[model samples]
Structure formats: structure tokens, C-alpha cells
Target: MKQLLLVFTILFSPSFSAQKTETFKIKKYQIAILGDSLKESSGLNFFNGKLYTFNDSGNSAELFQISLDSAKIQKKLNTKLRNEDWESLTNDGENFYIGDFGNNLGSRKDLKIYKIPFRDSLVLDSTKTISFYYPEQKDFTPKNLNNDFDGEAMIFLNGKIHIFTKEWKSKETTHYIINPENFENQAAEKIETFKTDFVVTDASYFEDKLYLIGYTKLAKVYLIVFKKSENDTFFRETPKKYYLGSAFSLSQIEGIAVNKDGIYISGEEFHSPLGIKKGQFFFIPFSDFD
Candidate 1:
């Protein structure tokens, strides 16, 4: 009888010990205040030692650069391009890409991305805009367009643009690559598709790795890491989730960007009795994520 009890204890104890060995890594992030009451903080990008972001729905759709150390708006430049539905922002070494192709209802036939030159010394008083369209699909009025595709996150790589769709009621995402040089009424080619258990909001590529961010219905935020595969594909590695605590009491979170310094995220809004409050941005040190 004692021997039987000892055997059972060993069996159960090993299982418990294995479970104890498995742990989720939780990283801490610091919330940095950009603006108090921003109407719609859509796209965020950190480039050339400055952080840039823009408001979606606003009269003066200007791109503002903030100092990384002080977190203060260093320069606010009015963009020549209009912000009809700007969703995501990314930058290569030479130019900044803004995704004006937001199709929430999946009914936007005229989706486009604007490429503006990255000027360091000169204040961007005026900018040139170039547009590109998806070649495969034309009419936005698909029977199941909601489940098809939409644009939210973009990354510029190797003289081409890579766009990722935001899965609004689904757990899958589609990726497309476009050569802006072939924007003469040509369509962007579909590259690959990836599915995740979580709903992705934004993504950024840095140091040969892709980082994806998602917001749960409970207002929780999760970070997913993927390494580039052999054929220039992205494969999911280990995923870590973090609770961003709370931002202004509202839950809908969006916008993510990465630089050599750290990872940055912005929340949409929180529900309040008085009214809806503007979103805020947070930064996580790159070392913490590493």
C-alpha cells in the first residue's frame, strides 16, 4: 500500500514539475504620453531618431515628429497628402510610407499608399504622393468582402512594399507585396497567408524578425514573434503576451512600430461615462523584448 502511494506521487509530481517548468514571459512597457486628446491616432513610425504619428480624422492632418527622449512634439509638419483614411505607417531608409488604404467595411475600391521622402534637415512643408492599387480585386462590394482582405500594416523592404491585412472578425491574415515602380495601373501580387489564434492589429519588421501585436476583447495586448523563413516567408516562433494594464479605460488598441531602441504601441479609446477619451502611446525597451 505504501509502495503504491509512492508510485502515484511520483507520477503526478513529475507532471506538476513539468508544468512548473513551462512559463510565459511577460515583458513590461512604459506608457509615454504623446497628446492628451487625440481624435484618431492611427499610424505610428519611428525613423531617424524621431517618432512620427498622424491623426486619421482631423482637419489638419499633419505628421508630427516627437523627440524620443523627452517625448515632446519636436516638429509638426503639414503633409500635402490628405488623410482620408490613413491606417498604417512605415519607413525604409529613404522614404516614409503611409497606408491610406483603410477598408473597414471592405468596400473601398480605391485603396492606395502614399510614399513621401524622408527629409532630415528641411521641415516638410509639402510632399509628393504616389498611389498603388491591388490588381486582383476591383469592386469592393464582394459578397464576403468582410472576410476577404483589408490593409492596416505595411513594411517597406528591398525596394518593394509589403502590406498585411487586419483580420477584423477572423484569426487569419493575408500578405501582399507590391513594386511601386510598376504602379502604372498594375496590381500588387499576393505573396502568402498566415493564420494566428489572436486578432492582429499591427506588425513591424526589425532585425530580420517580424513582430506582430494584437488586442483582445478584454483589452489585453499580446506580442507574437516570427522569424523569416528560407523562401522569404515568416514562420511563427514562440509567442509572448503582456497585459498593458489599462489605457484611459477603453480597450480597442491599434498601431505598433519598432526601432533599434524599442517597441511602441498605441491604444484607440476607452469607454467612459462622460465620453470616449483619446488614445495614448506606450513604449517597451528593446532589451525587455529580447
Candidate 2:
């Protein structure tokens, strides 16, 4: 595991100026502390009415079925794939897509997404890889966390995988698209851009509302919701940004999955020279924040 990189992100992350957003205390919504198995849980999503999650790079290429009531792992399903740097999770109804494109260093040349057909709660034998690269990223230098090519959020819609980048320097997110059907290494088409002022780690599109979750360099976590996207572009409308306390208080908020009942969020365990915080699972109802 990138322990040095983890420490670097926690201690050396650059700060950003604040923007006006509704503040909400998130400790009350935290239900459980995710244990060691999911201490590095990076993303969350609902597939076939079941919630699922997995750790990031250097972990097993397995998905854990999370129980909503207990926030515990109900089962683990192996995908038999290489978990180079799994960062995003989403489903296209019948298949689950995992984005193995965590380019925090902005030095990766081969970014890919795994597509596995899932049915009856089991993965089919046929698994495919959707390779992609950023055409705009001409330089292959290691910028650590200062680059804009790092992506940890994606949503599958309209026969496309839309990626939202975790812009470390600009404090913004750029929208890019990749076709899953293309077996060749395709260039992710940059479609839109939004100055979120916070790093977007995971995105969930529920109903007409698109939810983005991530934190800042100074550990301030945020949740932004864009509603009623008419042209498939979520940035078209004004989004409701909510301040969910600091990462020290609410863990390292990294994952979000929205449903009719409420919003499901998970944060990976964070540790540094300052202090250590355990990973946690949170459930916030729409009425509480909406």
C-alpha cells in the first residue's frame, strides 16, 4: 500500500478558500465504524437493490455486500481481476463497472475500467476491460497530488461512463466520458467542467439528483447535489452544496450512494502525524438535509 502517499495526502494537502454552503453536523448520521477489511473502502454503489463497496489499490479485487441495517459486510464476491487502483464503482443495471484509474501522481498511462456482468447476485464468467486515457494530459510527469488527472468518481448512464476528476490543484472537477463498448484504448472525451471548490471522490446519480462527495486539503468534507439535469450534463443547473464538518470529525468521506430512502456514505480510515481516524458508514435521510 502507498503508506507514504497516504501520509502525504493527509499532512501535506494544500488548503483552499471557503465558499458559502449550508453547514450540517455529520456525527449524528454516522452509524458504524468500518472495520479493518474496509479501512480503505474507496467507493460505494447499489447494484440490484444491494449496496456494495471495496477498498482501493493494493487490496483484493473483491466487492463486499454491505448490510444497510448493520453497516456490516454480508458477503464478499471475488471478481478475479487486478485491482491496480480501484477508485470508482457504479452499475448499468445488469453490469457493475469499477474504475481502476486512480492517477494521483498523474503519471499513469494505462487507465482502465472493469466491466463484469452481474446477475442473480453473481458475476458472470465473461469479464471485459474498458481502457481509456486523457487526451489532454500530454505530460507524463509525476505531480503527486497536484495534477488534475486523478479520478475517483464515475456514473454509468446513457450507454456511457461519465468520470468526475478529483482536481487537487484547481479545487474543481472536470466531466469526461468513456464508452464501455469500446474494447480498444479510447480517449476519454472531456464533456463539461465545474468549479466545485472541493475534490469529488465519488458520485451517485439518483432519480434526477446527482450527488458528489469529497473533501478538501484541510480536511473539510462536502456534499454537492445537482438536480434535474435536462441534457445529460449535470453541471447545467445550480447545485446545492452542503458542508458536512471536517474529516477529523467525520472520517475521510470518500464514497456516496443515493437512493429513495436516503443517502449512503462511507469514509476510509485516515491516519497521519496529527491523529488517526477510523473509517465510518453514514446514512442521512433526504428530509434531514434537503
**Number of the top candidate by lDDT?**
2
lDDT of model 2 at residue 86? Answer: 95
- The residue-by-residue lDDT of candidate 2 on 1-290, one tens digit each, is 13322656667766676656888778899889999999999999998789999999999999999998767999999888899999999999989999999988989998999999988555656889899999988888999878989999999988999999998778899999899999999999998899888888999998877889998777788999887465588888778888988877778887999888999999888765667788899998888866
User: What would the TM-scores of all predictions be?
Assistant: 0.77, 0.94
Compared with the true structure, model 2 gives a TM-score of 0.94
Off by over 4 Å in 2: 1-14
Worst ten-residue run, lDDT, model 1?
A: 14-23
Per-residue lDDT of candidate 1, residues 1-290 (tens digit): 00011223323422111101112222234365446534356667878767777766443557778665534677877666677777778887677777787665667666777767777732355344555666655656644324445667777777778887765445556777877555454466777766554446677888777777654333345566677766556754444434444333433456777788877776655553335545556677867655
Pairs of colliding residues, candidate 2: none
Over 4 Å off, model 1: 1-28, 36-39, 121-130, 135-139, 142-145, 236-251, 272-277
Per-candidate Cα RMSD to the true structure, in Å, reads: 11.4, 1.9
